[model samples]
Target: MKEILLVLDLDETLLYATTNRLIQKEDFVAGIYYVYVRPDLEYFLSQLAENFKLAIWSSADDVYVEQLVNKIKPSAVNFEFIWGRSRTTKKRMSLTDEYHYVKRLSKVKRKGFLLERTLIIDDTAEKSMLNYGNAIQITEFTGDPHDDELLLLASYLEKLRNVENVRLIDKRYWREQVKSI
Candidate 1:
């Protein structure tokens, strides 16, 4: 089977950053923001890296993304790419008149990765709305130290690692699927 490329979102998916500090201790500081890492993040990344080629794509500022990634990334793991806001498509919501950055999988295809073998994990639906087939929407991680989403996601993704076409899977019920496992 072909290798799958697992693209991850930084903010609110793997970690939460804000100017105001949370009651829980901050994992690290990136520029003006205090960052809180999701529980079991290191183990999650390490586990996934063994089965999937990993990358990071975030809608956050380029400098901030780099800083955060540098601080959190494990020394032994390598990412295929680390992209920031400059790589995202900015669009205004018709109903809210609010602008949000969207991560288009077409950009990953440009890099020669097959869309069928790619998956993007993110918290916000709007960010991956254009490519829901390849998206696995996770709950937003906002400095919840007790959150075990990553642990569950690691197990779920392991089940998907060998699939020929990741996009064909119905990931909307991924949490339920994990529970069954």
Candidate 2:
């Protein structure tokens, strides 16, 4: 089987940034924002890098994304790509006057990755709405030191490593699926 490309979101999925300092010390600071990394992030990235081609795509300022990626990414693991808001397609909601930056998997497809074997992990549903079949909705990381979402996610991703078609699996209840396994 072809190697699966795992595209991860930056802000809420892997870390949280805020101007208001939390009780705990932040892992780092990005500009004016105090950033806290999700627990077990280094472990998660190192482990996944062994099984999947990893990349990052965020709907945030390009410079900000690059800065965070540089700080958190392990020295040995290399990302296939690190993208930001400029790469996303801006779309307006049908029912509300809200706009969301959508990551279209077709862009990845254009870069030679098969959509059937690709996966994107993100906290917000709206961001990956255009490619729901390839999306794994992770719980938002809000600077909790005890958060173990990445640990659980690593286990879940292990199960998907050899899947013939990752899109065929229903990942809507990924947490429940991971627990049941």
Candidate 3:
């Protein structure tokens, strides 16, 4: 099978970590921030591993990113790489005063991945905007125990894996669903 790179985001995307609460094993507390993984996150990762070469590209620093990832995939066998803010470039959004750390697919391409065969799964659209049609913008996971987005995403991605060029799979499938609402 041809390999397709599936780059994932950590915070708010696959999991939600807040500094507002007491820290636990499930939570990664760095200085003052508390990070927590989404429910069924492990099963979600396992399912995706069946169809894609997974990698985590979080905007968080290296230490924090690895810590959070280790909490989930302790053996790190399912992921191909763990990329942090070091691989990202910062950009200030024109629409807002806040700056966004953009994770460009070009970086993944530089790592030898065919751009057409790669997809970025991030909750924040702004983070994956550069990739356009090659992204799956998910709703931010706020630690909801009943969240089923990943489960549905795994099904969608598995189906997408059969296609020669995943980029041709219009991201509008999710957008259409949103429009009907």
Candidate 4:
């Protein structure tokens, strides 16, 4: 199997949660209301796991991430690792000067995955701006049962599985194709 590194975002990317409210801490459960897992999420993830190294990088808290990923699979065999807000870095907003956390892809690179073979699937473009070309920005998911972003992404990733470098693939086309859907 190829070793493409795929970093995924949880909220609005893999699943849609109604709120970010903290609900529990004993067993690490949170966001139990109106949470909708993406259509084809399991199949998409299973396929991706076969073709690439899978890791989740969500802005949500660690407990929430654990709760969500556990629901996907109690053993969580589908993911190589899961990262929460603690793994992100705070950056000062240029416009408002307010500090906000951002997932620094560079942080993942330190874990031995080459940047060229890695891609971050996130809804927020700003979150991936640090590694512009390595991002596959998707539309924010809002509990749409008909959403096929992951299915389309599966096809796209399949084509790139054998490519020497994912960066060589035209990202504009990816953006256009995803947005058009």
Candidate 5:
């Protein structure tokens, strides 16, 4: 697949947590969408589209995803690509958790791409344990209605571009090596 799947956690991750009152001068006071603040977020996402598949596997309910879509829609979006809620019987499992589910999913989705090439952008550190070494965990995104974590997220996202490029090159070289033998 020549596309990268970047699943974002909407609540605290993308949309900053709101307090009792949504003061006009506080959280999101500037009206800047979370996806819009990150420097090159669109470009980074676009780049991911160039090499791997793009889909959203959020643990959030579909309603939230719908609201986000209504707010800032993805460039290359497919309603089917949005998956929410876990369909497992795992006791004590959080309904609002797609970390482990995404790991299991990315493997099947990116089976040809290899798990190591896949990455996860989340604010929760615990979720990082989902795929351990295979996934890249990016946290501490304030979504401060500004470009605070832009550099951080973009840097990690850049690594994925490397992963995808290397994967293609490696595949090409491997095929050549096999043909020569």
Candidate 6:
């Protein structure tokens, strides 16, 4: 089946990390992401994970991100991976952008995703090059599941995961294949 590797953002994208609208949480003591995931979170992610390979990218410290991800998703429902970073270690570019994330995803080829079927879901369209076809800009949630936008994004991700088969990149450009076809 076709697969997707997700580089989900921590704040505004998946769930708010803090109430003050700050990505950097200082007063929380442990310096962890602080926010309550919405009720639709589980059902939405459960469906998405069924068809996609998940990876968390918070820009939050790896150590802290792990704890927070575990708490937010204890059942491992939608998270196949738990990553933490905005900029790739080598290129030093922001991964929130589809171009950067696509490049960033390439670095981990040997380690994960034999197929470069990856996508980034974030609230901010900070990076524009990949904005048109490769992304879904979600409105940040504030513990309200009634919000329609969050519902739509979740539904969209779930639907995106199924494409019959996943192709391996192996010395080839996956995006090129998608574009050429």
Per residue, candidate 3 scores C-alpha lDDT tens digits across 1-181 of 5778889999988888776763345455656766667777788787777667899999988998887787778353478789999988898887877888899988888888888888899998888778897889888887666778877777677767767888877775764454454
Q: Alpha carbon lDDT of residue 35, candidate 2?
A: 97
Ranking 4 against 6 by TM-score, winner: 4
Q: Which of the two candidates, 2 or 4, achieves a greater lDDT against the reference?
A: 2
Candidate 3: residue 20 lDDT (0-100): 75
Candidate number that wins on TM-score, 3 or 4: 3
So what's the TM-score on candidate 4? 0.84
Error of 2 at 106 (Å): 0.5
- Tens-place lDDT digits, model 5, residues 1-181: 3445555554455455343333234323213332323334555555456555555555555655565645544567442255554521122347764424332534434445445445555555454344444444444544444543534554445544656433233221222343353
Model 6 lDDT per residue over 1-181, tens place: 3477766776556665553534433323335334656556666667666667776766556777777777667475656567765344423255543333222444445566544366666665553223234444566766564555545655555545664322321212333333343
What C-alpha RMSD separates each model from the true structure?
A: 0.9, 0.6, 3.2, 4.6, 9.4, 8.2
lDDT of 5: 0.46
Q: Give candidate 3's TM-score.
A: 0.87
Candidate 3 lDDT trough over 10 residues, lowest sum? 22-31
| TM-score, model 1 to reference | 0.97
Candidate 1: C-alpha lDDT: 0.93
Which 10 successive residues of model 1 have the least lDDT summed? 24-33
Q: List the candidate 5 regions with Cα displacement exceeding 4 Å.
A: 17-19, 22-52, 76-80, 87-103, 106-113, 164-181
Worst 10 residues of 4 by lDDT: 21-30
**How much lDDT does candidate 2 score?**
0.95
Go through the candidates in order and give the clash count of each: 0, 0, 2, 0, 7, 1
Candidate 3 Cα outliers beyond 4 Å, as residue runs: 22-31, 74-76, 175-181
User: lDDT of all predictions, in order shown?
Assistant: 0.93, 0.95, 0.79, 0.78, 0.46, 0.54
Q: Write the per-residue lDDT of candidate 4 for residues 1-181, one digit (tens) a residue.
A: 3588889999889887775532322222344655777788888888878778899998888888877888865343467689998898878888988776688878887887888888898998777778777888878987777798889888878777777878777775674564575
For candidate 3, the per-residue lDDT at 160 reads: 75
Query: What's model 5's lDDT at 69?
Result: 49
- List model 1 lDDT by residue over 1-181, tens digit each: 6789999999999999999999989998877899999999999999888889999999999988888999999997899999999999999999999998999999999999999999999999999999989999999999988999999999999998889888789999999998985
